[model samples]
Target chain A: MFRLEVRSSTPTWFNFALPLLAIGATLILCSGLIALAGAGVLEAYGVMFTASLGDSYAITETMVRATPMIFTGLAVAVAFRAKFWNIGAEGQLLAGAVASCFVGAIPMPGPLAMVLMAVAGAAAGAAVALVPATLRVKFKVDDVVSSLLLNSVIYYALMALIEGPWKDSFSGYPISPPIEDSANFPVLLEGTRLHLGVVAALIAAPLIWFLIVRTTLGFRIRVTGENPEAARYGGIHVERVLISTALLSGALAGLAGVSEVGGVHFQVMSDISPGYGYSGIVVAMLARLNPLGVVPAAIFLAAVMTGAEAMSRATGVPAFLSDVIQGTALLAMLVALLFTAYRIRRVGVAR
Target chain B: MSAVFEQIFQVGFLAAIIRIATPLAFATLGEMFSERAGVLNLGIEGIMLLSAMTGFTAASLSGSLWLGVLAAVLTGMLMGALHALFTVVLGLSQHVCGIGVTLFSSGLAYFLYRLIFGQQSVPPNIKGFQTLPIPILSDIPVLGPAVFNQFALVYMAILAIPVAAFVLYRTPWGLSVRMVGENPRAADSAGVSVIATRFQAVILGGALMGLAGAFLSMAQFNAFTFGVVSGRGWVAIALVVFGRWDPWRSAGAALLFAFVDALQLRMQASGLGHIPYEAFLMLPFIFTIVAMAVMSRNAVAPSALLKPFRREER
Candidate 1:
């Protein structure tokens, strides 16, 4: 008889295989959804893969989309590693966008203006994050609820600003005035949408990895996360580490917001992000909170998202089908991770 | 100032506040029960959204608002049960699992709603819940109408506070539930089934959340829209934290949130309103976060809250 046995620690192979298994499972489940939608499953898959990465422009689009995911994913991964749940990435992103818009709207010189806008955006995002970080450290407020609620509040605040004070005077649209051309992120490729933001995010990934692996602060954060009591005994100042990580995470998430506005949209709008902050959570989880792994994980999500539109156009499948696939991937990954952590074993004969 | 007082004293404004607070109150209490049982039901927003769609569709089809409410409640329960299964049985992280449930349900609900209703140029409208005024209380000039004149669900929501408080702090089952939340190992050794208690609490909370969603679809508005819930679930979660796990306090926080919501709506409707509509829209969320920050310091959560329980080796 086939039997299952418990393992104290998951094997290395299982660790590497989990994400692949999750992707496979998600594809199988999504294929059923495609069939239900009256589309041929193979054709749907074909459209998705081809449209996401088949050509140069598609690849560029994927990178553009993946840029923000990389920053936000790293933001989340860093905080999660520190055992600090900063669910307010969305709010932070919005704050960053608002700040960037403010900086960009000012008539400053080109390079200095762009750098200042990025700095201002990062500052604003970090400032918004300070409330929850302080509350979690000082008052023990659950960061999850505060961060989530703050997101809506920030979104509404952005809407208020754009619709009220910052409304485009000439166009009468509910969007901010476009930033000066000099303040905008320079496009990296002549014919592609990819911008300097992609470079910023790519650089941030390895920098974060280096910080976690080499720095004293990173050591404190890891120690605090592993054992708060022991870390406290060791004089690590757990709360300080948490607060710093939360702020850093917020800053990174803010950079994502900056990239969206300065890099892509060139102006701040109310719906600046299509839940990139939330999507970052999935990317972080899929990467197992590894800073280095975030790059590949983000690219995968970006591909799936980019492909969904193509699949929809070609096969009459709803682009929203991608959301189902994404959600299923998250769920499958969680289950796979849990099984890897601990397996149930029969103590004796089967009942 | 007197004129402002007079306006605040008006029955219509009071009624509006109570009406607005009704769904929030029910959901807050439901969240209270779930959190108190050591499970944070972050899926509350998604549950409300799904229920709103289901309840609205059912009522529209059956031509009975009550039946629609039932359908909404049942759907909420199922979602709640799913959450409980994942968090309580499968031992998944409450935060992630809750998020998954919300995303899954929200997307699924939207998909299904569009599939069934088709994207009509105008949204479907249905008959809404009618008010049932308390005979004696309705006679009072302003207070009576504001407090007593409401839909049946509103009355049920108001009644839930004391009932919830009594059940949570008074009864044997309540003690077991609290035990499970406080110290699951001890509770398990003392013959309390931790899994069963948590499951029950979550289901009960889900049923209430369903009723809350039904109220949004069946009473407050005569139709269901994609944004019906509108971050109310997050508001409820914040209220639970602000209230510090007490049923009455949670209800009070919900009432406070309702007042802000009503005030914002009123300001938007008033021609002399100074605040931007979006600012008003964001006020409740801002207030909730502030309140959470203030109350978080001394807040005493359940000892076992958010930690999945496993029986210790004998």
Candidate 2:
């Protein structure tokens, strides 16, 4: 029999190795589904790899897909660090998209339009996040349930907008009117769809990392999450830190929406997010809630997402395999995290 | 009565409200039970979806509704155990594990359904349960037919409230569940097996959630669309909080949500073409959040909810 013994300190190697282990385990586990679907596991994975990372075009596409997730990953990482549990990132993302789209639609100068869009989107996201934070602080309402429930409300609100007021007149489709042509994000590469928001996402990660690791507020956030009582004892206003964390988190998630509107789809729609907000949770987990780690984690998920579609086209496995992988990776990462805290040791008796 | 109000309280509207509430009642009760035992099964959304798929597949393939329901309940119980394996035995974070379970289960549901049915223009459908109207009670025009003339599962859900309340408050097992949820250490000291009781409660909760799934696929929708259980499980989560985890109040909360839903459906069907139906769809969720704020003054979650018990830690 083996027993778990607590480690004095987790080795730094575990931080990187654990995510890889989780990904490896996730693939090996999901391979059974491929086999069950009557497809060759290697062949499906091969297609996914080549299609998502095969060429410059594919890499660029993956990066395009990864941009929003990077933002969301930062959002969740910051919030979780402060123990705020802002599960309404999906709603926040939608609110940001709507706000950004509202700004993007107005006839204005291109660069100025983008700036205002980001500001409105971030403010909208922050406002949505503050609800659960305030509720948790003032009313003692459970943040988890409130945050989760708000996703539905925000979703319906988006649906109402597109299907009613924002209805596309020409197509007769239940989608919002497209944003202004000038407001479209500047394409970074000549041919590829990669946009300026992608570059911004790349830069935003390190900036967030600095805020979380090097700033005074970051120390307060870390302390509050680790031990609220101690943080209060140490003169940190715990509630204030939580509210601030919510603002930062919501702003980052809102930026995910901004990128989607400006970079990918330049209009608010029913499926603007494709569950990217939830995927952020997976990315944050894989990153071990470290803002700096979010970039690679987001890229990995983006690759899976881009690859899964190609895998489905080539291999006949459902495209949902990527969704399963995301879920499995999260669970696997959680299980792997246990090893950081405890080591298995042989015991003489089972007990 | 105004034109909208006139449509909202029609006999058919009453029946629609009951039909809508049935799944929610079951789901709310299921989540309530699990939370009462100190386990927050955030996997309710995915659990309901997976169960709906399995139950629908079983009924369609076997041509037996009861068999399909049984399969769904069993699937739910298995998933519940899986959740317990992580949260209770392994002592993982309940919130994360629940999210993981939901993602995993929902993904599996979609994968399996597509594989088995082979994506076609129209999804496969099964001839679902018929209204098992009571001979005498269903004869009553206004209330009787709406309440009594329902699917067998609907009747089960209606009865579940009192039965659940009885089991939670009357039975010794109920005492154990409450004890474990409130103070695991005290319960352990009192010779109650906290882990086992929690496991049992979660499993039982899963069974009820399975019934909710079964009702959706086998009775309400009669087809297993991907969106069949969309956000209903989340609604159930809110209902549990709003219901204050009491059986009667939870069931009432389900009914209230159903009334709002039924009203929306009626308004949609009433040629109110200009109104966005989604606005009405948003009502119950908004209502739940506000209700939680109002109820938080008095309502308290399980004391030990989200806390893992390691007997040796203390």
Query: Pick by TM-score: which candidate is best?
Result: 2
Model 1 residue A141 CA deviation (Å) reads 1.7
Looking at model 1, give its docking quality level: medium
Tens digits of per-residue lDDT for model 2, A231-310: 99999999999999999999989989998999889988899999988999999999999998999999999999999999
User: Which ranges in model 2 have alpha carbons more than 4 Å from their true place?
Assistant: A348-351, B271-273
What tier of docking accuracy does candidate 2 attain?
A: medium
The chain B TM-scores of all candidates, as shown, are 0.96, 0.98
Determine which window of 10 residues in candidate 1 chain A has minimal summed lDDT.
A1-10
What are the fnat scores of the candidates, in the order listed? 0.61, 0.71
| CA RMSD of each candidate after superposition | 2.4, 1.7
Worst 10 residues of 2 chain A by lDDT: A342-351
